[model samples]
Target chain A: MNGEAPFVPDERDRALMLATQEGLPLAVRPYHALAERLGWAPEEVFARLARLHAVGVIRRIAAAPNHYALGYVANGMSVWDVDDERVDELGQWLAAQGEVSHCYRRPRALPLWRYNLFAMFHARERAEVERAVAVAAVRLAACFPGAVRAHEVLFSSRILKKTGVRLDF
Target chain B: MRERRPATLDDLDRQLLWALQDDLPLCERPFAVLATGLGVSEEEVLQRLRRYLAEGIVTRFGPFFQVERMGGAFCLAAMAVPEERFDEVTVAVGAFPQVAHNYRREHALNMWFVLAATRPEGIVETARAIENAVSLPVWLFPKEREYFVRLRLRP
Candidate 1:
């Protein structure tokens, strides 16, 4: 799906997204805590959250580890130039890979930018990240010559700033 | 709980991380369920999570929703920041509240970031502001489409 206004936000979903972006309180009953704060029953909050996850609006209800803290200092944003027709399959293939954290197909800015598929890889060392990229390169080469055009990985040198997307108000 | 450095991920810690990354079961007792399956007590699960949270190992532990679905806007923007002014431009761009997920990548488009705003037009305005401040051309690559966006780093 394009990053557009695809889903209609009901009142409950709005409230849930508004609250949980700060993060769920680390308590024995986080849903209960949310219910108390938002003036909804714990069951309703839980069920609605479940529905959000089911519909793919909520990507996950899990812990997000900081790679830096986990000693994964190197992060490579690998971009691939694959045949438009075959990108969907390649993206799905990359998504299934444990090394590729994020895989997406964006509009290719031709002439200047030739890549379409973007997959991110993380590691504690550059060598490890290089190896991962090398494997991807070889795999891409195995496909038809024009099917996989070119690939490049842009390793982030520093995180000038980073925070999750949240509603300001 | 015993003391461990930031780099070290003990046996229990690794298991806890794997649980958190892949499938943190959406139940009343997510920790309890994880503990039961991983052969640990609920208290231990919670304790490790708290530690992970405190130490910044885990950035967020909750439901992640799409910003666009809720009326917010986000787009990926990149710029070719000269090496001489790399750090300067980084700090200047990072100062904006609308900008998040900024990075210095190894490419001609060295500076990359995602700009998120409460409104759609705000994203464009933020991009312009970045260009003016850095005195560099800002390329806006709003996702014409999206195939997948998931991050599950194996511990």
Candidate 2:
């Protein structure tokens, strides 16, 4: 997923994005509402969105829940020092789990940082998250014995800031 | 920060949140489509969504863009600010528009943040600017590969 090619949005697409980048309209017929604003046919609006989604530009149109507000108080970033030869395999296995929110293979900053696999887990309690991590570790060991050397779960204490990504264009 | 009781959601709320985790249909009335699936009226769905947004339960409702596909880049970076200057350094770090989500975690590298930039080089440039401003070395961990990224969460 990190090797995705570039997609330069043309003028029309740019205009379409600029119109709804803040958010999709809340009206009963949001596409039609957007069409009215953009002075384009409702069909065109839907078509553009469909095309963007098909090409991987837009991942999806959905509600992003505030985990903390929804009672997911424990946010742990579980990092693992797995075999470099099979880190990707381990990452895929971990990422497929329902509890792993985000998983990726990152570079290790050695000595101080030897973990290359990062998986984020969220739960209502710290203990629950810890247990989940332990279970994952055990399962990983079973899948590939001696593959994982060490792991640690870093729990976030506070959210200093969390404004979602924004693009001027 | 305001504290809300954990697991206070009713069944309807849970169902609605779970339903929304899937990709919303690209139709004239996306919410209406979702409402039908949940056996509720379009108006009710909209009302609940509005309430959730107003109450801070839902942070955002819209398209989830893959910035990398749009010629942008994001990196997870960390800094270890001294105990005495954590607050001051946080303000300095937050000043950057590229710094997206910043979190305070318990570790030697206590401060972790994600930087989103229009181009790949922008991430490095922003990190350097942050280092100069905070007078601390910022360690970046760019993803070599993404196994999976769940855009939505079920509470």
Candidate 3:
């Protein structure tokens, strides 16, 4: 996904990220061009890309459209508290959810922040976001017998320096 | 932060945008690949891309990486600021180089920010520094597992 789990990119992964991060070339065989630049076989580069994409290391080889332009003006980083033991299944479900663009099972900072499950919900407006949050909350509550403890939809009133996270090694 | 503006799209622009998202083609002269698919010229494809970049319609025209794999740490953090100190604290938090994103949200934890740091420890260090600077408790929520993270907006 976006800010995926913590892990060090191998030399090869670093090479790929660095070489292609500046936008792939506008050539017939862009990967072939990438191969030529990296001094590796075009086929090898293609295979590596396929592998990385499969493993979620490379989310997609696509254009990240401006969400605001796409009508999702108001987006909320919806965080929830659920029994940690029961989060895996719920997180997986949320990941597959059409609206939950990004889903993660983060560690809980108890007493202060008990939200172990974070799902990003986007919509054209705040009310839509609240409705989506309510839907997801209901589903999560079903999975967990205990009170959700806290469900907060942090609707960003302002945004600063938003961009895709990169591995710039 | 960016303002919400209407991004007018022509049929050609929409076609080109779709092509760019669908795997930038894995062939020689990839733009030509897209051009051929859209029944346009390779030069036209290149021109459109340049314009899109210049116009800020396309923020990035490349592969998006899994940041953590590249030896970086990203986290969602927040602080509850007094109404009087909201702007002051927002400026203070925005000053950190690692603060990739800071937002004003409506909730108890009103001030929210995303931190992308070179090292895992850097996230904690920055959080602590911000907490001390604003004299408020900073709650750090580091991602333990990523279930899904794809933002596909079909034009």
Candidate 4:
């Protein structure tokens, strides 16, 4: 059996995740502060974080702005039913656009759901998002004519729950 | 529900938001490194970041882990609930630890949420449990392929 083995973080790695899960310290020397707290050298903390990043465990160390707080009140999940053969290509084009925050190719659920491509976009106003999506559709038609069949935008009305995943070591 | 208003920000704060979206360097003085690029003092950068967090302008600031790379699974699941039971169903669904984020979208499938689990089977199990709790069929739309996913936002 050639099942891919799961990556189990070592004690130090687990500690690192736990420490930075909430967020990294806002000190002048954040790594040094982490090292002092974790009882490791500053170099060791940096090396471990670098290794995690290299191995694709950490996507990035960056700030996530709250869309609502930034005047982007409308969050639209624009989905499309594109030609199966060219869906991936069109999806890549959509993803490259700055307006699209998240784009993915998901399976259609037959009669209930017909959209296979999902692109999430945010805007200060719902109309702005719709206008931008229309512009994008025009561009897609020009580049990949007849590739996109139908599309719809689903705006999130409320956030029922928002939280991060917690892993038990 | 908490009220949300756009925070008034200066040009420096705007620039800082744009700069912070990019990956910070792995160095001894990372904030200082960012300060140099932003042409501001390190203390200023730190102060603004702290304020942003405190004011909920920035949801999080740190390393984003790709759980899938660590043998975890995430599934985007949705459900169509009767309007009367929507609130009750939301609480039942949110009770599951595996449900990372839930959103109410304007669609027939009005309730959507993401499930993140340590193992792939955990997702299936949690979905089954949620279905049992809510008595609604959960439509799991796992990503067949990812084209792009950049979570940065312009302030």
Query: Candidate 1 residues B3-25, lDDT tens each?
Result: 12345789888878978886566
Among all windows of 10 consecutive residues in model 3 chain A, the one with the lowest summed lDDT is A160-169
Q: What is the C-alpha RMSD of each candidate to the true structure, in Å?
A: 4.0, 2.2, 4.5, 2.7
| Residue lDDT tens for model 4, A1-169 | 1145656677899899888877888888988988888889888898899988987778799887777788888989999999999999999999988778889999999999999999998888999999989999999999999999999899998878766565533
| Docking verdict class for candidate 1 | acceptable
Where in model 1 is the C-alpha error above 4 Å?
Answer: A2-5, A10-12, A81-98, A110-112, B1-6, B23-26, B71-73, B117-122, B145-151
> Per-candidate interface C-alpha RMSD?
4.6, 2.1, 3.8, 2.6
Q: Candidate 2 chain A — worst ten consecutive residues by lDDT sum?
A: A160-169
Between the candidate structures 1 and 4, which one is better when assessed by DockQ? Answer: 4
| Candidate 3 deviant stretches above 4 angstroms | A1-61, A139-147, A166-169, B81-97, B128-137
CAPRI quality band, candidate 2: medium
lDDT tens digits, residue span B1-155, model 2: 32345546788899998887678898778898999998999999898888887787876778877678888888999998899999899889888878877999999999999998767788999999999998999999999998865635566
The per-prediction tally of clashing pairs is: 0, 0, 12, 0
- CAPRI verdict (incorrect, acceptable, medium, high) for model 4: medium
Best by lDDT: 4
TM-score of 2: 0.91
Each candidate's DockQ score against the native complex?
0.46, 0.66, 0.49, 0.65
Q: What is the TM-score of each candidate against the true structure?
A: 0.82, 0.91, 0.75, 0.90
**Candidate 3: TM-score?**
0.75
- Residue B120, candidate 2: Cα error in Å is 1.7
- The C-alpha local distance difference test score for the whole of candidate 4 amounts to 0.86
